[model samples]
Target: MREIIVLSGKGGAGKTSVTAAFAALARDTVLCDLDVDAPDMHILLEPTGTRREPFVSGHLASIRAEACDGCGECAARCRFGAVTRTPDGRYAIVPGHCEGCKTCVVLCPRQAIDFTPRTCGWSAVSDTRFGPLVHARLDPGAENSGRLVALLRGKAKALAKARGLDMILCDGAPGIACPVVSSISGATLAVLVTEPTPSGSHDLTRVAKLCDHFRLPTAVIINKADLNPDEARRIEDFCADTGRPVLGRLPYSPDVVRAMTARLTLPEYGGPLAEAAAELWQAVVTLAAASRPQLQPL
Candidate 1:
């Protein structure tokens, strides 16, 4: 099966919006929202009957009040100040402040600290009009986003295999971080959506270099090309210099915002933007085939 990942170097580059449009355009596809930390694809897709499961990361420390000696030992050992004396004179572990390092657990003289599997967040599978979507949410200030992204990708791939679909369309997180790495791993291609700004240009190069490091076939699409023609051309120049094709340039329009505000993809609204999306998707399909001639069917 061929997997296509939609990624961006920064947030608000319209990555998820483009992915939502692609979902509406693609046929026989399994969808995945890999932006676990701040996922919003479901807002447009409107998924239902999602099955949730705990995502266990590292262990969290909890003080067993009954076994505590009230010696202030745990509080003194915690570098994060997670251990604190309660109003009732009992030592307590603040769940958020605790880094789950277990240093206090090991240092406690009373053996009152308990280290248990921490529920970092949850992953879920839901059915949308397009197809089965594998998505996740990371708890506030939680860690291991890369691991959760990997899990979500696996679930999406499995669902694609089960449903006999030929493609997996993933909406990846912003930036070239661990989460993006996990999202792009073993993918057939990476579609980068970028805006026309100095910051966008800089981040595009950074993310492109990362894709190069992983030997991923990458392409670019400039959104809101009308806002800044110079930077848009600069983006094209960068793509040309790196030999990555500029798939399409979508014009700036209020229609996009109107469509989004109504919880719909541009393609579903049947406008100039939709036409551009169709052209972009067609180019993507052609390139994917050219990039991997013998790609297996799902």
Candidate 2:
């Protein structure tokens, strides 16, 4: 199956907006929102009939009050300050402060600390107006975001296969971090949505290099290209130098905000940006279907 991932070098680059438009336009596809830390696609797609399950990763330590002997050994051995003395002068493991290092669990003399699986977040399969959506929500301050992303992608792939779908469209997280790394691995194509600004240009370069590191084919779509003509040209020059395709440019329009406020995809709202999004989606499909070397994870 062909998998197209929409990403941005930084936040507020309109990546999710473009992805939602593609969702409205594409067919026979499974939609995936890989930005578990801050998922907002449901706001536009309005997913329903969700099937959710807890995401358990790593472990957290809690003091068993019954078995505790008020020994300060666990508190002294914890380097993260997760173990602290409560008001009753008894040592306790602070859930938020615990880093799951198992230091306290291993070092406790009384063996009062209980190490159990942590419910970091949850994953879901839901129905949207367009198609099936496999999304997730990571708890605030939770770790293992990359793992959650991979798990969600696996579910999307499986759902697509079961439904005899041919495509999987993913909305990836911003920045070249662990979650982005997980999102791009084994992707058929990476569509980068960027804006015309100094930070946008710089971050685009960083994320593009990250795609290159994995030997992934990439394309660029400059959002609000008219805002700064010079910076847009600079971005185009960079894309040319790097041998990445510039699919299309979307002009600045107030209707984009209006459509967002109405909780509608650009295409559903209908505007100049919607037309541009349609054209970009076509380019992405063509590129994704083109013959290329098999992608192997590094």
Candidate number with greatest lDDT = 2
**Model 1, stretches more than 4 Å misplaced?**
292-298
Global lDDT scores for all candidate models: 0.89, 0.92
Q: Estimate each model's TM-score.
A: 0.96, 0.97
Predicted candidate 2 versus true structure: per-residue lDDT over 71-93, tens digit per residue: 89888888898888888878888
Q: Tens-digit lDDT track for model 1 on 1-298?
A: 9999998899989899899999999999999999999999999999998999999999999998899878898888788988889887889999999999888888888888899999999999999998889999999999999999999988888888888999999999999888998887678999999999998898888888887777778889999989999999999988877788899999888988899899999998878899999999999988877754321111
- Model 2, runs deviating above 4 Å: 293-298
The predictions' CA RMSDs to the true structure, in order, are 3.5, 2.2
Clashes of each: 0, 0
Q: What lDDT score is found at residue 95 in candidate 2?
A: 88
